[model samples]
Target: HPQNPKPQNWTVALEKYYLSTMYSLEFIIGALGNIIVVFGYVFCLKKWKSGNIYLFNLSISDLLFLCTLPNLVNSYSKDQWAESTLCHSNRFLLHANLYSSVLFLMVISIDRYMLMKHPFRDHVLQKRNTAVVVSVAVWIGVILELLPLLYFLEPVTAANNYKCLDYASSGDPVTSLVYSMFLTVFGFLIPLLTMGCFYLKMVCFLQNRSEQIRSALTLEKPLTLVILTVVTFSLLFTPYHVMRNVRIASRIPALNISGGTQRVITTVYIITRPFAFLNSAINPVFYFLMGDHFREMLMAKTRQLLGRLTTTGK
Candidate 1:
């Protein structure tokens, strides 16, 4: 008889260990950072800039994503499966935050681009009410996109343990493929393209202006911020989306994937999946590092809190 191949038990163990460690770190960093950002925007800042409104909403979305991390960490670390409702609900919240964060970031990029490229129209377009309306629309749109997950994510029992949102438990391959395609395209690709176009346009606009004009407007720092935001978004999100499509493609019967190939895909998916969650933690860092106005407010809030604490101690 031909020699039988062995399963990659070590690889699976390593992947699980990696996920458990990183998800916990991501949860701590993302939860604390997003809370501070959201609180600062709501309570510390006296007035909200149009862009701050969007950032506030983004932080809330991140916080919501972080809220799901403990359950995820528990599931991955303990290798314990979740109940059906919990599983589908967690998946729904994850996707909702993922897409909403992308959309809000896109909105911010557009807001910055318009500020740089069409300064004259800022008053008409950049308003608090407008941001509120857009934020509402974004929430509604994300909910609609992810609502199907609740219906489709059936519960399963494997090895005498119940599992929710199991890939093997998915109802129909055709339905999964269609839904995954829609998510990959609209959720990731389109928003990515939009942000890219705006960043490119803003860069071109800045380069065309004379040095004196650029300095007078103080465009360099903000331009750098834009570049950083675009780079960060690409770094964190691209892998997840690419590997997601790969996983979906592997499920097709025509592909006739080998066990080893499936193992490779599974490992890659496991690694990249957290990158989506990592986005939540990173956005607050970007705001602190690159956002001048936000940084100042954060500092002011910190000093004020410290002073009050010192007084209370006295």
Candidate 2:
């Protein structure tokens, strides 16, 4: 990569080192958090409950996504894509994780709508193959959608003196801008809209039918707050994403980010991305484990583990 007239400040090796450290932490966080979600869902929540199916699917996606993080950590930490083809593929894996998470969230929201509004819907109430099929199909579609990144996102040398990521090495500046826009809108925005709309429908339906609220509110207060938090999260993520792409496109000197203020505009990329990924791990404790049945299952599992520890004399 040749240097543009305006240079980025960081050195490549130093930036790689910093990214390596951050990725190490990210891997650990994702591993432990998503594993907990996966284990709890599989061992305890596998039975068909009103919402557990959606949650279990979400956990599965997160778990599958987390499984690839070590390769990512290795990519930067080892300071070479020489480690394995796996390391080269880690960025695509992460992108697939993003898509998987979005797809599962949509499933959850649609499930919520059905269970709340049309409680007798066979798809919502009974054990069915559609959800499982849909989840698998969704991952397949996401992989295909992200296939181009695999072609373009080689371990390219960075102009910023780092092995950081960018879109295709060859294309119009506006091409990346368009891809980023698509990623933001389809990957983040539309699913978020789906979440918001269906959750709103669920809330309205619940509030209308005194029976559902009476049953749920009695058993779940802080539990209900989990959904509320998710709704709030969706609302907040949209603008951050739009600004992210706008700032990314503006990173091109030709886009004119405020006459030598490109750095500040581009800073949103660094600032907001961690917040988004961190959200994936944040919901486990409050959303699933804190629900009544789930809380009981978690405590039961915790006690069982402690008991095993005592028995093993470790």
Candidate 3:
């Protein structure tokens, strides 16, 4: 008798359960947090700075991505009846929101850097119109970059069930590898480097300025925001990318990795994957923590909502 094919124990039942729970929690918290942030920026805030524009766009991206979590959770939990079209659209929106969020964060970092390092050029480069144009460009670029996935990422049968957004099951392995490489490099690495450089320059500028001048410049808020952005990217995005590459590398036949190792990689990916989505929820916390104005606006809105509820009850 032929040796039983290595028992495929990659059931991931526990992982799926955790993912479903986490996705549900993320959707509720992320949607509410991002909605508050968007409302604060759009209606409560009197003035819109360049950074505020980027934050608003980021909030929209988070909200849009959070909107898709239910479908994603369903895919993880139930039989995937999602067609190829829905799968492609979900994949596109997921990546589009992710890269666009990174781009907007980079924009915010650059805006803050310029405000501190080259205050003289503020009139030309730091205008609200400039930020709006850049934001539009980012949206277009992310959409175009991910458009190919619609063609390549088709629904495929896995474990006798149809699955959507399962790139590994459907796409050309080489193409998947290339796309992951591009995403990690351009989407993660480059932006990370750029942010680091901008922050370094800002620190240098602060170092050169006199205490009185530095005190007057009052860059603590912007600096805090930069730190939060870096932390968010590091904690959420970094592990996902690293594990993704490792999983891709494990697929190579030359590596001759044991079945057990592959299983471990898959488990790690499942665990770390949701973290990328957590970024959407955590960002609103950052906004509330870092922005006094945002907090005040949120409190005022909460009070108004309570007043209306009490009046309605009476």
Q: Evaluated with TM-score, which candidate comes out highest?
A: 1
Tell me the deviation in Å of residue 60 in model 1: 0.6
In model 2, what are the clashing residue pairs, if there are any? 11-161, 12-161, 12-162
- For candidate 3, give the lDDT of residue 313: 100
lDDT of model 3 at position 226: 85
lDDT of 3 by residue, 89-128 (tens): 7777877778888887887788878877665545666788
User: Global lDDT of each model?
Assistant: 0.77, 0.60, 0.76
Angstrom error at residue 278, model 1:
0.7
Per-residue CA lDDT of candidate 2, range 95-143, in tens? 6766777777676656655554454556633345666667678878887
| Model 2 misplaced stretches (Cα beyond 4 Å) | 1-7, 10-22, 67-88, 118-126, 151-164, 168-171, 211-213, 216-232, 251-259, 286-292, 308-314
TM-score rank order: 1, 3, 2
Who is ahead in TM-score, 1 or 3? 1
| Per-residue error (Å), model 2, residue 144 | 2.4
- How far residue 46's Cα lies from its native spot in candidate 3, in Å, is 3.4
The superposed Cα distance between candidate 3 and the true structure at residue 178, in angstroms, equals: 1.7
What TM-score does candidate 2 get on C-alpha atoms? Answer: 0.76
